[model samples]
Target: MQFNVHIGAGAVLASALAAVGVWHAYSSGWLTPAKPRAGLAINERPPEFIPTNGGVLTIAWVKAYETFEKRSPSELELKVPLGTVKVPLPFGETVSEVRTAAKYQYQVRLQKRWPIQCGDTQCVVRTGPVELAEPVAIYHGETERKTRSGWARFDKAANLEQLNRSLGLALVVRGNEPRNRDVGMREGRVEIEKFVREWMAKEAHGARRIVVLYPGEQMVDGRPVPAH
Candidate 1:
């Protein structure tokens, strides 16, 4: 018996092989995927985009200060280091301005003789609310820049007033750290997670997405979709 092979059979086989080769190239990173098209579906006027405000949260390293005791005129004062603190921000609030609120350390030094009732004869010296240098911007993201100073004057139009009353989210200051890798820093993170978990439990606001913004690489529980 003579078998008849169609001429298109060879062409079909070649087409199948070409498709497989293209797929292999894609799998092997030799081929890059096309970028998604931006804009509205169908005939659109101005693109109407609703801001979901998916709870944009930011954590920032605030100010650090030192305390010391000035003894006599000849005696030098010993300074004690105060670790850096993380100041929280109001939820859904975009900071329009950042200004520092002054907090000062005062020391009373002995000037003239006092009565026996006063244990230490000292002049009650009133010092300044000495302003510290502005904190250097660490995480340079859009939200990070706005929230850098920790204390922010949120935009009035952000509708924070309504959100604040509904959300009941307040900026909380946790532990103090001398540096990012400080032992207290880890402890602070733990505490922050605990706080977040507790806060989540209290919310009956249905399912919501939590997006954490960090400076460097982080180990997430599952495979994370890269934002970049």
Candidate 2:
């Protein structure tokens, strides 16, 4: 009995060591880059969602860059709206309202975060660098601000201005695409709702996200959920 107990303990200890070894291997990214990695392929594409009543919502991603490198998001560019809307971000509110091409509506601002650790997982995610997506845009204004940078004057005046804040026209959203009298647009509404749910699950509080609602593409006079 004593001998058997000793053997069992030894086996269990060995198994645990093996398991820990495997976990560390995974988390530390020891088994990656089996193939030569030239570099990470960085792609930034906006995800679009179509809803009922001939409307579409596009979730464009914005990335922070050297003040000049990425001035505004190209994917979802917004022309200056006629009026600037000042919606409130009530204390402890995940959703807020702003002027659309039309009126006021609620949009949930969410943030996603990933710990930058070793180089392997870093390479995969940084390839796309999703966590940094935001409302990036270039806007036209009255004048440019001149500032000294590394012994040089730079022209910098690109931001969406609100009552007290400088906000960018971050996202482009439209209603259903023009209905082709030929091909019927499929109902992808259920799929879209699922996506938002998943994004919410991953997004934490106080994180801001941009949503654009499209209203007029499918219908003759579709009213879009304007993202101001």
Clash tally for model 2:
13
- Candidates in order have lDDT scores of 0.31, 0.29
lDDT of 1 by residue, 99-183 (tens): 2221211111211321111012111111112122222222212221112111242344343333333221111111122332233
Best by lDDT: 1
How high is each candidate's TM-score? 0.24, 0.15
Candidate 2 lDDT over 32-130, as tens digits, reads 545533222234223322222322233232221112122321232234445596453222211112232211121222224322112211111111111
The residue ranges of model 1 lying beyond 4 angstroms of the native Cα positions read 1-11, 23-29, 32-181, 204-214, 220-228
Q: Model 1 lDDT vs. the true structure?
A: 0.31
- Backbone clashes per model, in order? 0, 13
